[model samples]
Target: MHLLAHRGYHAKLPENTLTAFASAVEVGFEGIETDVRVSADNEPVLFHDRVAPNGVAVAALTRKQLSEVCGYTVPTLTEALDALPGIWWNIEIKTPAAASLALPILSDYDSSHRLLVTSFRHDVVLAAAEMLASDCGLLNAHRPAALSTLLHAALPHPNLRTLVWDCEIVDPDILRQANALGFRNAVYGAKTLYEHQLMQELGVHTLITDYPQYVGLLPG
Candidate 1:
């Protein structure tokens, strides 16, 4: 199983920052997952929330303004990739505008094997599959109406090979069905030892976890 550090191994550092990403690499994780949002000046920055704690929208601030407000540098998508090369990246486009802003930057890089762009918004994944050089995935938070139904709708796009489900919704049958349909099973929110054990037995392809160090020690 491939273990991806969620938010760049942020257990000890600020998430989506260069420091956090470097920390993930330092600890030897193969890949890191991060979120992308477009700032007011049209720069694609690494941030998770749509609104700041101060009730300001991330899109309403420039990259510099965001850094100042957050008290840390909000690295651009380009900056993050440039700073950490040769590591696999799971870039989650947080907004439709972010997909447009981030895809061009991703295209300029060597992305075919090293990048996977995903989103909860299926529309973003649909649009990205047409234009992106990297692989695309759909992130679902709950169990769909039917696993086959989801695969049938997604299989038309050849690049959409991964089904990122929340761990709460995963079961052996669902994982088995998804695998039979040629989809890679990836999940997040597997926090406990039992959950990790369950994921291992189910043979998940990827585990996007916040506690990479803890999960890395588990028998897979």
Candidate 2:
């Protein structure tokens, strides 16, 4: 299974920052997952929360102000990708407006670098699939009632080849169905050794985890 450092191995370092991303690389992770939100200046920056610690919306602050508010430098999406060009990125767009801003930046990126642009917003995923050369994935926490129908609907988009599901809802049958429908299954929220073993047994394509050090030690 491919292991992606969720929020860039932030067990010690602050998450969604350049330092964390570099640390993820230092530990030999080729993939990193991070969230994207647009600042008030319309710049796509790497940040996870809807609101800052100072009780302000992320969209209400400029990138520089966000860094000050958060007490650490908040790297713009471009800054993060430019600094770490080799690693595969799982860019989770946090809002539809963020998608509008981030897509243009992502379009200018080197196409040779692998990217799996995903979002809980299906609309954003569809929009990204149409515009980007990179692979786009639909992220879902809860299982949809018509799983096959959801797969069939997404299969038409050539770039939409993966489904990022919450590990709580993933099982062998889920993987089998996703595989049968031409979807590679990626799961997040797995935090234990048993869960890691279960993902390997399920034949998951990717495992987004918080503890890469431990997960990486598991036999591939």
Candidate 3:
């Protein structure tokens, strides 16, 4: 199983900032997940919230203007790929526009071995798959449901290899069902050592957590 830094280890620095991403690399995390949104000028930027820290909506500012006002510049998809070379990325498209913007950039980057495009929105996932085709893997974030329902929903997508479930949805049965479906399922919000052990025992491929270090990825 792998330990993935959530929003670039936000507990240690500002979430989705380049600084935070760099810190995750420094700590030797193999993968990092971050949210992407398009600015008013149509440049893709790494930011989770529609509203900025100052209560200004991100859509209200151009990418360049957003950088001047927000202290951190809005980074393009290209910029992020350049900044974090040689690391696997889980880039979540936050909206349809972002999905559209990301597909081309991802293709241009064309590092299918190093990037997985994911989205909570089903439409975004479909669009990304259509655009990216076989170049990148698609990860689906789904709420926990009955084993039968999960099996039904997942059976059609042969290319879908990763699933992220809410922390509340994790149970032995669910984990078993996901494993049966050939998915590398992960539970979010793992706050304790016991939870980490439970996930590891269940064969979860990754743990999305604020404290990646506490999950005991590094040798004692």
Error of 3 at 159 (Å): 2.2
- Which candidate has the top score in TM-score? 2
lDDT, candidate 3, residue 88? 78
Write one digit per residue (lDDT tens) for candidate 2, span 67-183.
999899999898888899988999999999999888888888838678999999988999898998899999998987778766765777998999998999877777787898788
Q: Estimate each model's TM-score.
A: 0.94, 0.96, 0.86
Candidate 1, 1: how far from true, in Å?
A: 0.7
lDDT of each: 0.86, 0.88, 0.72
TM-score of 3: 0.86
Model 3: per-residue Cα lDDT over 76-96, one tens digit each: 777778888778788888888
State the lDDT at 176 in candidate 1: 86
Return the top candidate by lDDT.
Answer: 2
